[model samples]
Target: MTDYRAAVQDMNFLLHDVFQVSQDWATMPELAEMMDADTARAILDEAAKLTETLIAPNARQADEQGISFKDGEVTTPDGYKEQFAQLAQGGWVGVTANPEFGGMGLPKTLSAQYEEMMCAADISFSLYSGLTAGAIMTLDLHASQELKETYLPRMAAGEWTGTMCLTEPHCGTDLGILRTKAEPQADGSFALTGTKIFITGGEHDLVDNIVHLVLAKLPDAPAGTKGISLFLVPKFLVNEDGSLGERNPVVAGSVEHKMGIHASATCVLNFDGAKGWLVGEPNRGLAAMFTMMNYERLGVGIQGLGAAARSYGTALEYALDRRQGRGAKATQEPQAEADPLIVHGDIRRMLLTMKAFVEGGRAFSTYVGQQLDRAKYAATEQDRADAEALVQLLTPVAKAFMTDTGLEATIAGQQILGGHGYVREWGQEQWVRDCRIAQIYEGTNGIQALDLLGRKVAGSRGELLKPLLREMTEFLQADAGQWSAEYQQLADAVKSLTEVTEAVLAQVPSDENIINSVAVEYLNLVGYVVYGYLWLRIARVAEAQDALGEFASSKVKTAKFYFAKLLPRIHSLRPSIEAGSKELFSHELNEF
Candidate 1:
């Protein structure tokens, strides 16, 4: 794990040379001063140092010791507190938060790398800040000015942490059946009473004050999701002059004993006549919470990517160090006793598979992060709208595809280590366990797939996908002559995916279950096509750096491997998607 690097070089390559985000940022009034390549690289380098040296070392301690829950209080492992304070003092907690509220005010394009590095260093410790960042962003967008003035400064500064309370004991994805009740007081605040479960960072010793963004229903509210409302419920009530008052009626009912991420507290929070304030208009709580959930979705996707990246580093190390097998075509050896595991073809295959997906995902996530930045800071209305559309279209893909592939990469890494990976000390199993939750929480991969197919694609009738599809087409049309063959292969896949998308759309309205039936396959097809385009981009850049010799050559080789081996999975997925839901529902519930 110590050998693991955060892929800062590739992140910089994507942001500065490939995407030219500096140019985009320079044009925007808000980001001009801090948008240069040097600043971005410097920030990434600093983040790498912080995570690698300070934060990463604490990960094993946190996982092994786990957090303690006694009397509604959760205490992190020994080193967790000091490292967390360092993280907050560095202002990394609010790297992309609002400038007016003491945040760093950086672009998501840059901060996304920070989030990735932090997660790679220590995900358990990182969640506390990650959820806080998401909450601050939501408050900035939807909270009233008074609320923002009071809450944003402390939260953005990391003095007060935040959590999102959306799940209930019975209601998970189906928020329409939630039973949380909110009664309005004469002071214009609401008295919220509900028990929210699976709330991450719900109660902790890291901060004295914890702010919860809870979703509850008003008395006269409408039925279903529309009736739900977002509220800002603090652990301790804030005084008029912005001081901490008496403790509110919010407490952690219990902490969940989980298979992984033991250092992070997952609590069942009980709100007993708790004081809270409305975030947005009534009956639109779902929409307001999306402002936070959408941010967390990408953040969660990066967590998966980080897990894969770290696992790949650890597995590669094991393969290089462990001596057993000989090369397939070895005629001679310096030491005739044995050779390293890397000599075997099968091991090389596993390593390459991990390499291809992790690198491809790096490109994809950064591309999505750039879109997030443009959506927020691009100069024109249409530019902003286009970026926003692409953001909506790809958010679910980033969340689902990355986590799905990430889980695969981790398991492959575990297999690479054989018996040692199964043991606790080797830490490969921990990577697998920690990463498993990302796919399940923050919306399951299945749910994300449905969102991609239903809401983002078919619901918009492919209109939402046009901006991204057009970007791929225009890039192929561009003068990327040196990598013509690979680019052309990606071009063909893009065209095929476009046709499949149209076919899926046509079948969705006619068959009610079409989107649910083909959602996972459709998302995978889109992911492969997306990764193909990104691989070509990476290859073109690698080719320009032939002077660097092996490093650049490896990049080109990985691109070829990805296109040749991994991209074809999309072809198999297409037939299943087109085959529709008839076979899926063919068997009755009693038949099983």
Candidate 2:
């Protein structure tokens, strides 16, 4: 397996040239105080070196050895402990946590790049720190002052890890059916009694304690999801001096045997009258949990992007170095009797396709991160509200589209290697396996599409989507000197998406199941257009840079491929979405 190299140049291009975070930072005091352009680049460079050298090489071995479960205890593969220690010592877990509580407090736009690098290096390892970061964010946002003082610094310092426990044996998506119960005690705490499954980082030896943010209901509370509340349940109780006390009743019943991410623990945790403190107001836990969910959803999407990026790098290297069939043109390797795989048109197509999606996705992720920054640090309430609206509108697309296409990109990378890709030795197969879960987890791509079409778009009567279209339209109307034709095509795409969104809205009044049936297709249409917008932006920046040289030239070519080849995918999805749910419900229940 080839060593995974982070796309630092592309990251810098998106940060400094495309999104221009430096100027944005100047407006927001929180970000301005953190770092400048050079500082941010140094962080990315350092993260790339750390993950590539220390973590990437150990991924395959860890995946092979996997996690071990014995006597309700879970242990990671060899070398993970030392690697996790390094991650903690570097304060990577709390990169975006509150700086007042011993965190770095960098912007998500910067931390997100580090996330991509870590995931590319090894997703299984990335989850341990990623989940911790998400949990830290949730705690900071919703937890009380005492809880924050007790746990935030320790978690930020990497002395402990965290998990989000929301699933059960009977419930996966519908939290309304969850059977967990929380009983109030005399000590002003709640004793939570429940069994939660599919809890990542639930039980692991990498840290001394696990902070589980769980959801349950009180006895007299209203039924269904409305009654649920969030709890801060620690594995061991904390004393007055902020030291670990007696063990809580929560224990790992068992660890799951999974398809991928073997090095990360997926446990079935049993909380038997576990003493916990309420994090927020009762019966509104789902709202608070979304704080973490939204962040993790984006993180999961980056996981797919990271794996796909690594796949492209590995496949591209193999194509260049490995000798293959003769080219259509005269062979450069006449003495060697065969040409490299790069000479083949199909291989180039595959390689370019991977490049198009990976680079476009990177830019899109950064764009979303910029929105997050605005949502947090923008001066005025209206500015923050507008940014938050965009974040809500595009997050589903980011999670679903990136992962859905991310899986496709990984498969294409695997296909480039043929039989060698099917085997584990090259690590392409692991990427395919690992990337598969991104679409399923983090509120499944299908659910994301429904949220996009049914909730965010139709729920707001198309208001949520208007801001993004306006942004794109403004960009297209601007002076993009040499890229007029490409901008026009993007204009056409935006026009098509606008029409499709309106059509869906018009049909939803009569077609009850319309959104569910065509939701994925609609989301795909939006994704392609969004990527097209970002690609053109990247290409425009690349072309204007006199110093970028070949890097700039490659960006222009990839943007062309995206416009000429991939962006046209929307042409097909548009009609599918327009077809409505009629054909889907045409068949009878017994027809199959």
Candidate 3:
């Protein structure tokens, strides 16, 4: 496994050079002085130490030991309980949480970089804390002041963990069919009864208590999604004196036997008349859950980027160290059995592809993080709205594209190691397995595509597309540099994407099934073009940096590779998106 030092440096580059997040952090008076470059760097260094020394060292062992579920109690692997305690005591859980509730109150952009580092180090271990952060955000935004005061501080301090209970056995994407029932009682509380499957961190021994943000339907509420309401159901009810009371009705029915992320317990939760309190207004649980889901969607994207970084690091090491066939143009005789794998152009191609995608995804994640900050802390309403709109539009793309790239990058990395990559000891195969879930869990990439094409782009008659296109056009027009063939290629790719978007919009509504049929392809097209734009941005920055002269040269070369090898996918998508829905719908259910 790769250490966290390199990951932190990459994160700093994305934050300071690629995104210029300091300026955005300065906008919020609360965060202006607390998150300077020095503080940020120090935070990164500490996180690296904690991740490399404490969390990452146990990654493989935990995966082997897995979480044990016996007699309704979940026991984490050895050392996890203590490490999780240190994680909470260190205040890492509250990096981006509100200050009013005993949190560090850092900006989202900085926290995003931290998240990437953590995920790269050990994704399974990180999920235990990540879910708490997501649940805290939802509670802070929608839960009552009493709930916030009681739970946020404890959650931030790591005394308790939190889980989002939305996916039942029958309902995942279509939350409209969720059967959880919430009946009001005389004491301003409700009894929640339902089973939530695949709930990450739902049952863990790392915390003293677990808080569940459950979605259930209320009696007399409207039907479908509108009838859903969010509730805070704790594992053990807390007494007024901050002591633990009797255990609530919520119990872990069983822990799942998953393909990866074995350390993080994915529980089947049975909320059998669990005592609960509504977080927000009735019939608006989905709206509140969206707040958490959107944040998590972006976090999942970071997971993809982090996994890519790990894959790249390991593969790069192998390529440089492992001896293989001689170079294509070897001028000198080989001294050893063979040459380093890096000598091969094909190997270089794979490495550079991984590098390009990882770096581009990093930049994109930071960009979205900055947008989230602006949405939350901008002084003007219009600025906030604009930032929020961008966040909404790009969230799905970030989730789908980053993970798709992650899976591809990890596979490429594993290929670099050949047969050694498939084994368990090297950890290469584990990266591939752990990363696979990022695409599937956080609203499958297919669903993300549907949301982007069906809801985001065409939702408002291309209103979102117009602003994004204008922004890209302005950026390309502003970079008036000479002797930059890669920049020109990127500009062409952007123009191609614009035309494709317009064509898709024109054909989508006329044939209602077109969007669903080609949503994945359209997403890939947009992803490639957007990444091309990121490569261009990175090249421009590298051009001006003297400290990283050699690195800048590599960036230029990698950007060229991206344009030449990767961006052509955008053109491939045009016909696919225009193919109409017939191909997908052509097969009848009985044909199988």
Which prediction has the highest lDDT against the true structure? 2
**In model 3, which range of ten residues has the least summed lDDT?**
1-10
Clash number for every model?
0, 0, 0
Query: What Cα-based lDDT does every candidate model obtain?
Result: 0.89, 0.92, 0.86
lDDT of 1 by residue, 1-592 (tens): 4455778877887887677889988988999986688988899999999998898877887899998999999998998878878888999888878989999998888888888888777789889999999999999999999999999999988899999999999999999999999999999999999899999999989888999999999999999998999999999999999999999999999999998899999999999999999998898989999988877999999988898889899999999888885676653266567788888888888999999988888888889988988898889999999889989989999999998999899999999999988987778898899999999998899999999989888888888888788988998987867667777788888888888888877776679988898899989998989998888888888788767588779888999899888998887998998899999888787853
- Clashing pairs for model 3 are none
> Candidate 2: minimum summed lDDT over ten consecutive residues — where?
328-337
Model 3, residue 317: displacement in angstroms? 0.6
Tens-place lDDT per residue, model 3, 459-544, is: 87678867777777788777457536766776787777777778878886578787788889988887887788777888778778
Candidate 2 segments whose C-alpha is farther than 4 A from its true place: 589-592
| Full candidate order by lDDT, most accurate first | 2, 1, 3
Q: What is the number of residue pairs that collide in model 3?
A: 0
Preferred candidate (lDDT higher): 2 or 3: 2
Candidate 2 lDDT score at position 511:
90
